[model samples]
Target: MSRRLTLLVSAAALALIGTPAIAATPGAVSADFAQTSVWGGGYQGQYTVTNQSNHAISSWKVEFDLPAGTTVSSSWDATETVSGNHYTFTNKSYNGAVAAGATAAFGFVAGGSALPANCLLNGATCAGVVDTTPPSAPSNLKAGTVTTTGVALSWTGSTDNIGVTGYDVYRGTTKALTITGTSATVTGLAPSTPYTFTVKAHDLAGNQSAASNAITVTTAAGSGSGSTWPLKVAPYVDMGSWPTPVLTDTANASGLQNFTLAFVTGNGCKASWFNAYDPTTGWDRTDIDALRAQGGDVTISFGGEAGTELSGSCTDQTQIQQQYQAIITAYATSRLDFDIEGAAVVDHTSVDRRNAVLAKLQAANPGLQISYTLPVMPDGLTSDGTYIVQSAASHGVNVSLVNVMAMDYGQHDGIDMGVKAQQAAQATHDQLKVIYPSKTDAQLWGMVGVTPMLGVNDDSSTFSLANASSLATYANGKHLGELAFWEVTRDRNACNGSLTNCTNVTQQPYDFSKRFEAFTG
Candidate 1:
């Protein structure tokens, strides 16, 4: 939680305990602003708009002008439009009405040096509006027997000063689904997976209630006739401003259903604020928050091609474990991916320690999915890469996926990048079967993942659009676990000599994403 939110929440609780209400004249409307989190170049801001009139308002809008150079990257609870320094936000269908004395809240993440000023609600100044109340949480959450592919969930309805608009279902910190009804069924679950579920209710005014009691449910075991394949696609999203783009913009423009948030590493050796999120634009939770609001999921990835791994600094077992736990708590995503490269992969001690910490997290977080992104060759995984998977199994770590970077095969020598990627996936699949001897070939393939750098890779090898199509077709036919590309930031038609950032080739915007999206079923 951010410090600003803590203070606001505390104030709200006190107001409920008979503290005199902040006085506002009847028939006047007002707005309250709060800064949730801030970092180097940007901040996450929230606004609460209240109606003090005796009658209800059919709809409302808030407008403001951001400081020069600042831009709104993502938003929630309202529809937003930006023109130059001006931004206008209107209520969505379910949150358009504001009852008498009721309030609604919206949040946004922006990039720049400062926040907007002179905010207005419905063309009126927001200087006098004051609301410090939170809605009540829903209760009586129940989970039915989990099926092989889905789970049935329901909960008691919650009341609000205005009206309950919708409910958000979280598998952990990541929202699994959102709906307006009291009951919903979540599908696309892995067989035999144990999951923990929680729910929260929000009103038309945008104030969310406390979380409901968590319920545990395990999906039915596989029928055992054959291996079940779940083919999904996610593109890598950089934490830095590489390729000169923000996460929300890249995500909104992508065709893939999920994203892998890249490279959360130590600022330097033994830095304070371990796992402290500082993206290229700044530290703004609203990026991920807004993505979840749009029904997109994310997997927090640690380590990248560069940077000092936290394990390198926090050598102590306790410190290392705490660092890992901090990330899990912050994102609350059911999935975690480790993109091991350079010394991060070769350090045997760090590898063992990482696997140990991950194993403990898996045991503690039911239904947590763990994936390892390691370097691979045309034939198969290198010795170190093999140790990564082997160490996980040896340490009792239940790894759900072993995704190989199929780009930059070291010695390309003019082989088709797509064909090499397929060969690498098949080789990794074969090795996985040897590691888990009991798993069927289909099951082993289902546990394997492949990521290709779209267009030109670091080694100057090109993965053409036709190559992307070929890989997608192969992935679907073989029922592979997942297919992902190097990044969404570079999924465009033109390149700017950025071998590692942009594809640097002639292609359409999101062409690779569109090609790989075909793998989704």
Candidate 2:
């Protein structure tokens, strides 16, 4: 027989195979049902029917006798028929005939004053249903007594029907953490701040039940250590991409524990040049304020070469200076990052000019931070013969750190270019330290773009989650300041290299549209 015909015959034979069956009353079908109470609202029910007859069943009908105080709401796959408070779901027709040894399924939804008890499926009566309910009431949900800059929250495990898949943690109204198989630890909470926490259980079907009891805990005071910086893992929320505030906030809700940093467009001048900020319609001060109130920080980044307007008459120094002041004063931000690329023709004058601009800004705001980004150059040479590292330092301008665009550099060349790029960055850092003896390795920040599509012809150059993790480990081992990516939207999360992987340690997503409220410990 043909290959396709042989496969069909095998499937038919397998379908007909069965074990010995017990005798049952004629015209009667044995039905079993599963019911689960969902957390937000509503309940889910699953049903299985055994065809005890010697013949095949073409169709089936399942009638659920809901107890007092419940009513049928809606259902899927089957048509729900209601009479008073009871619900009956009729299977239109089985896609394939169910053999005597096989089983089928049908279910419906019911709404009522309270959860029903002693629900019956088909003609069979069951007791209070199966207690497939997951563990409940996450007790002792408080921060550890020995408070520190971080908050330690613990809770009891939840029960499940077959088994509990995991626990999702929420800080106040925002989901802060997702822990598989129960326990999870939430770090990077601000010192001396109070936070509310709640936990929920997830089942194999991805069904999450009601939240456990709520508890509040305050973080300990800060020790003025650099490690104390709130290190959280949050999702990326982009206002420019999401013109609507509601959509932006919803996107943020997916990964609440992560920091939210906005992507603002600046012409290498002031911070708010082509401001996407909308007070009444989209992300505005209110959004930022709300984020801040929730123990999150909002940072605005400038100079994205992708589509930002960086070339124009605004390149003039007077306009640049005015725009800079406007951005800093209006936004009240302590730090600003300059994405220096493409515009090298206009901005690359001398380290003296760069330092003068930066110093003037710093003098105006004593607490301001200035960071410069450089294209990943394997040779670490500017077109003007200026050493990027030596020039910045000699001009009395604290470069903060360099964000080497490694992906771009490698794509232009190959994977071998990455190693060369890393070597160049290390060499520059070493040279800087030799000149500035007090400077530590913590001042260097490595930039890597996490994308699935390999830029260079070499497949090994593709940035995967594993690649990010390995790179992060390397940076940390070298005492590098931190790892930053080109854009969070380009991250691959689905393992297929299309979605952003928020869980990746090397490059966590940061949403910049939200507010920076103080942590309430």
The lDDT for every candidate, in the order shown, is: 0.72, 0.46
Off by over 4 Å in 2: 1-239, 243-263, 266-283, 307-319, 350-354, 378-391, 410-425, 434-438, 441-461, 492-521
Indicate the worst ten consecutive residues by lDDT in candidate 1.
Answer: 15-24
Clashes of 2: 28
Regions of candidate 1 where Cα sits further than 4 Å from its true position: 1-231, 242-248, 267-283
Residue-wise C-alpha lDDT for candidate 2, range 339-382, written one tens digit per residue: 54565424545334545666667666543545555554555534
In model 2, state the lDDT of residue 1: 21
Tens digits of lDDT, candidate 1, 54-98: 545656788988878899998888999988889999987567667
TM-score of model 2 (CA atoms): 0.43
C-alpha positional error of residue 253 in candidate 1 after TM-score superposition, expressed in Å: 2.4
Tell me the TM-score of model 1.
0.62
